[model samples]
Target: MQRRSFASAVSAAAAAPFLMGAAPSGGDTPASAAADKRLKRDMVASLEAELQDRDTARAVAAWIYDIGFDWTPATAPIGAFDFLIAYAFGNRPPANGGDPTKVLAEPGPMNELLADTVAQVRAKRTLPVYAQWEIAHFLTEKYNMSQVIAINPVIAADGTITYLSTDGVAAQIAEKRKSTPGGVGTAGVVGWRDHIKRCVLTTEGRGMKAFAPEGFTMPDTYDPESGQPWTRRRDLYLVHDMNAQWQMKRTELVARMYPNG
Candidate 1:
């Protein structure tokens, strides 16, 4: 699809209200549930078509909008952080000849990765990139990337970071676009592969012309005993995919149930 048509589709999807029907409740009939399921499926299909469109993927945007992931105090950084680093550095080969598993197993490799990422961002990026949640804060401090704008994360008095919902992040981006002078209305939504479709939907739902290119996949580790890869990351991918489905359905349901609100 052409960029103009894509933008129109996004706007129409964002502005379109839910098909009116009996809302689901505790005493809802099977028919109502079936209707709900069909509605959700149709919405998913529409969003997926946009995501899978080659022209949509190739469409250039003024800003790269990275959706954040979990960042605990103990873990410090998560898979999405690695994705952000890789994107900033243009996914260049690691000094260890592009082996991600080695980068994971080797000591001090992550530090080196950070240093290289910082250098790349500083050299290549002319403007501050927008990243949601605590990843933005962590990237700024650790990579010395003063060029990252963090959106909608709460930092407590004790320094604990509380991240907001994906919808919240999308809404904030929409508001920012409206406020900025001569701001480009399009953005490239970035996140895990399983999560990117939902992110793009939420972004478009907020009236931003957004498309998700191929998302970054986290490297999986092998099982020590079976020598099988993706032992743990398999579960992670499944959980993320399921959660993405639920979140997308819930957003539509909420909008339908509270049409006036």
Candidate 2:
């Protein structure tokens, strides 16, 4: 069957919140181009150096996954594919979420698949390339998802695992979310809350060392069981309590940056 384009799906999903009267007006602050350029340079340099050592490359990829999966806030659709594209390509905004001229231009379709894929991977942490290809096809042919599955795999040493493929990971996450008890909507919300509190907020306040690396110093203000600085945890709870209100306003901003399927 024919595959759907990314832009179409995004456009459709982007309209959902607005149609529901849940989305607000306004766009997210796009990341600074200069900062993005610098980050790209640093990341390329880091990846280049690490790739020379096979073990190091694997470790780095694993680290990327840990930080990525850990820190991503569970608020609304997080646009994991968009985030990866922005990070990988650097300094270039896609014509419509991804490069239109190159391929994967259909924003609405691609993002719908992306949203579904993220939900899947967040649950199972694994997937196959063919499955994702099928998903891309299904999205295009069946659901008008997106036609972008242009990424190459970052294979493991034993060759039994594939660590990086935006579409593949997404399919895994989407499948997991489907089987989840509360369903995609509730799981996404709850996951985002947990991620925000456990990952983003904590990392922002302290750093990555808190959870990984045995010698990592614990913040004097942190409680072992609670996983946050005492002062910050209290503040986060208050903030989290207000998240529903905040998200209602923020969804529009995120949608503007992401658009939808």
Q: Tens digits of per-residue lDDT for model 1 on 140-246? A: 66667765666645556765544356677777667766876665455555443334456566676887666532222322232232211222244644455456655
Clashing residue pairs in all predictions, respectively, total 0, 35
Candidate 2 — worst ten consecutive residues by lDDT sum?
82-91
Q: Could you tell me the TM-score of candidate 1?
A: 0.41
TM-score of predicted model 2?
Answer: 0.22
| lDDT, candidate 2, at 108 | 29
**At residue 116, what lDDT does model 1 achieve?**
42
Task: Give the lDDT of residue 58 in candidate 1.
Answer: 23
